[model samples]
Target: MDFVSELAVARYEKIGEIVGKCVEKIEKPRTFSDVIDTVVTDKYVGIPIFLSLMWAVFQFGYSISVPFSDAIDVFFAWCAGIASRIENPYLASFLSDGFFGGWGFVLVFLPPIAFVFIALTILEQTGYLPRAAFVVDRAMTRVGLQGKSFIPMLLGFGCNVPAIMATRTIDDEADRKITIMVNPLMSCSARLPVYVLFAGAFFKESAGAVITLMYVLGIILAAVMATLFRKFIFGGSPSPLLMELPPYEVPTIKSALMSSWLRIQIFLKKAATILFIGAVIMWFLATHPWDATNGGELIENSYASMIGHAVEPIISPLGLDWTAGVALVGGFLAKEIVIGTLAMIYGVGEEGVADVITQHFTPASALALMTITLIYVPCLATLGVVRQELGSWKWTGLVLAYELILAYIVALIVYAVASVVML
Candidate 1:
């Protein structure tokens, strides 16, 4: 019995040694070629993982924006109150309502925008986003674009101007032009407020889903538009998508924070400069003809009111009233200014514009308006860049005309469909 027990112990020890060796081999560091081999062999899991990462990114944008946005609102309200107590009402109004409100609107969105850029930068640094482009390459090729064009499109989600500028990376001039044209359709962060506010107010249960759908719709529209342009207008063969995936590394928290801070700074500077001017202009329009009888409230009989009334007829078919028309016009300067314009026009304050819009506009109208905003002409900054890069106003004019036509057509379709279904 003693000899048999010793023999069993010896056999068990040998088996344990073999298992340890197998585990060490499995845990060995993967070589570059080894990783590529694995990726090629297991694309199913790799593709899903890529998608899951994107979903997490969108989730991060929504989650991080909430607290930061609230803080910005509080800060702006305090500033506005302090400014209102100043001696000169016009100067105070210009500082608080026009400048602060306009700039504040853009500033409040920084957290989410920064988070998105950081996440994307991390993905870029870690080499996964290129892989994403690789996975989507076939689909992009079908639409007459190289997978590399997606890099700028992804960047456009943070801001469209830089994304347009980034198109310089594309080798083919025709491909680059097409890329610049479709980058706006990727639903940049500037448009996020519209999507989030409306989705929250009207489709609370499906807010995330609805927002996701809008993003997908934007991408689909871009792909279709690119395909059509290539087939008829551009007249070029699809470019080959070629990229090398870099090895993954642990993303530094410090680097990520710095990236976020820089982005926030850029956004703030834009708010302070371009958006400040826009907001003041909007305020001048919305607030004038001092109403002494109405407790000094800025009356609608001011200069801005006259312009709103003038443009109302043209935009009313899209379900936008004169007030909405003003907002649309303001949006031409910077897409984000629409919310601020509405806030100022409705006297709802910057944070309250979404709520006021929800209260006044039906879901159908709101959706239609959102669609129009999505497909409307590029902002001044974008158009300037387009003109500079394309080297002529001809393409810029074409883009504007095409987008306006598309916006009107799409807005009408959405309105018609919603009216029939909802009724």
Candidate 2:
């Protein structure tokens, strides 16, 4: 430790010794939190326990959200039915199928999104998240990131824009930059819809496990990439893990709800703005050629399809079809738009979206697509922030180019490995 840190620790230890001597209990008993922490922060089992807890969170989210999703699907279908009976085909299609169908499909994922945030809030409120960070700090240090980076990386689970902003708390320039660069690999919640959709469709029996694996895969890739960055791009040793662990307390219901609501509000806002607009644009493209026959016909020959086809050969080796290509293109605006774009492209309402995805993607291809979505270039907002934070278009462009290349390479490897394993 540095001289300053060593002195600081010594002082805290001395104070702790005095406090222990000053406090006495009639009955010496460890608190419930202490017992839980003993196992939760254990060196041997902490990471596995943390991972298992996350798996359970996803499992709960999927199971509980399904009913709500169905309700949304039925409501949207009814709206489409009403639109179909309208005399003005253009206005009807625009309102019912274009606006509602496109955006509503994306909204169907709100339940699971909210559920994920709620679970996260509970963990944060209970003070387990910081412990999880502490548990993983050793592994992170080996990858050129200290425990401080874990907070920003965990924030990336909600969104990358704010997560990048959160890196400002790191005092060291190299640590902050490295943390920002790797933040995208944390599997933001926006990508959860994509994972849930594909996992439910292809790996139904183990959908939660599959989604958990996607998050775990993101962490692994982030660590590997951080190690590479440390070796090649930025030559610096990681800072020591130094942070205070807050006392575990029973989280109040109001606090958990407020936390979950705050995070989920971001998703709702994006669905209303970015995803909403992207849905309309996609719907128009899919319905274009300005012909009545094409309005409700197959989207295979539409302009969007052409764009996807143009990029097909580039991503085809990864087992992603034209639709997946187009979705990735739309993903540039926001990751959630990938789900909405697929909804528009398939012309399947939210209810049938999973079945359509199942028909189009095999287990190997689905895994590849999820990995690519997790690691590909940041969203438009995140990109702007990166440029702003780095103060150089040159560095921002480098970050973008490197991420795209890394995404493709990782995705292809995943496809190849998944294919072999499935065989």
> What lDDT tens digits, residue by residue, belong to model 2 across residues 1-423?
899999999999999999899987587677877888899989889999998888877788888899998888799888887886788877877887687787677788889988888888898998899899989999999999978999999998888889989898888888888888888888888899899889888998998898988898888988998898888988989889888888898889899999899898888888888888878887787777647436757687788888899989999999889999999998998888887788778877667778788888899999999999988998898899888887789878888988899999999999999999998
Best by TM-score: 2
> Each candidate's TM vs. the true structure?
0.85, 0.91
Report the Cα lDDT for residue 358, model 2: 82
CA deviation > 4 Å runs, candidate 1: 1-51, 290-299, 421-423
Error of 1 at 178 (Å): 1.5
Candidate 1 TM-score over all chains jointly: 0.85
Q: Say which candidate scores most in lDDT.
A: 2
Candidate 1 clashing pairs, residues 3+ apart or interchain: none
| Window of ten residues with lowest summed lDDT in model 2 | 289-298
21-77 in candidate 1: lDDT tens per residue?
A: 786645667687466647642567766676667767766776767898889887987
- Superposed Cα deviation of residue 380, candidate 1 (Å): 1.0
Provide the lDDT at 199 for model 1: 72
List where candidate 2 sits over 4 angstroms from the true fold.
Answer: 1-33, 296-298
